[model samples]
Target: MKGMIVSRPTEGDLPVSLDDLGAAARERWGAWVTERHTSVVPNAVLTLEVEPPGEPEFTVEVMRGPRSINLDGTPVQNYATAAWLRSLMPADAPRVIVFDDAWSMHADLTYGCTAEGLRAGTVDHSVPGWDAGDPDLY
Candidate 1:
């Protein structure tokens, strides 16, 4: 089902430096990234909208520290797709939450990004229509 994916840094993971993030964005996304915004006063937040050369565009909201990095993109079709999306963030991110309201059960699907690789799990609650898996919602 279509959903929103959010990845966050664990206690052990270091906060990504703004410079490193900027370089990483350029390296990983290059000119494919159409827009970039950063807030540094109250808090450091970097937002990027990436539209690959062709189809399938997405938006990423990155916050400093342990705050969550919300990623709303094309619905993952397979584990590889999920992994690719996860790769967009720092490798230290330990888990990702996938929320899909279309599911009659819980809407959140949690995935652990461990050294052993991604592990899927169930969430206790639901966030109905969180993103409705819509890119335009960004």
Candidate 2:
């Protein structure tokens, strides 16, 4: 259930400083986020565990770069969770893209967030030789 979260902010809307993005994982994930022992790449990353009570717990590698924080973890299976994730995006972010590995052509898992709202769709994994028509055949 791996995935990538990317956000690109406009020049005029960029945060004044990286520090302006907030300092705590709680700021982004709320009180459910807990610090844990996990190694990350040699970059500014926050390794934490998100345990939302009854829901399955997952690891989140929040990589903060010069502009936005990159969130790496599992994909949301429902629209409620997707909307929650979108709500956490920084105000400077004009568009937020999320790519989920468990996505299907009919699943509304892979999506993007913008002023227009959450735009969800599928990823075209169609390859030249893998055009079998039957999805499972691939």
Candidate number with greatest lDDT: 1
Query: How big is the positional error of residue 3 in model 2, measured in Å on the Cα after superposition?
Result: 3.0
Find the 10 residues in a row with the least total lDDT in model 2: 102-111
lDDT of each: 0.48, 0.43
Off by over 4 Å in 2: 7-31, 36-38, 66-74, 77-85, 90-92, 101-120, 127-138
Positional deviation of 48 in candidate 2, in angstroms? 3.0
lDDT (10s digit) by residue, model 2, range 6-100:
33423332222334333344686688877643355555445556777777666544454533333444345223344445555455544443434
TM-score of each: 0.49, 0.47
- Clash counts for the predictions, in order: 0, 0
Tens digits of per-residue lDDT, candidate 1, 11-84, equal 43323454565676678778987445564424437766777766677766565662545455654432333444
What's the lDDT for residue 4 in model 1?
45
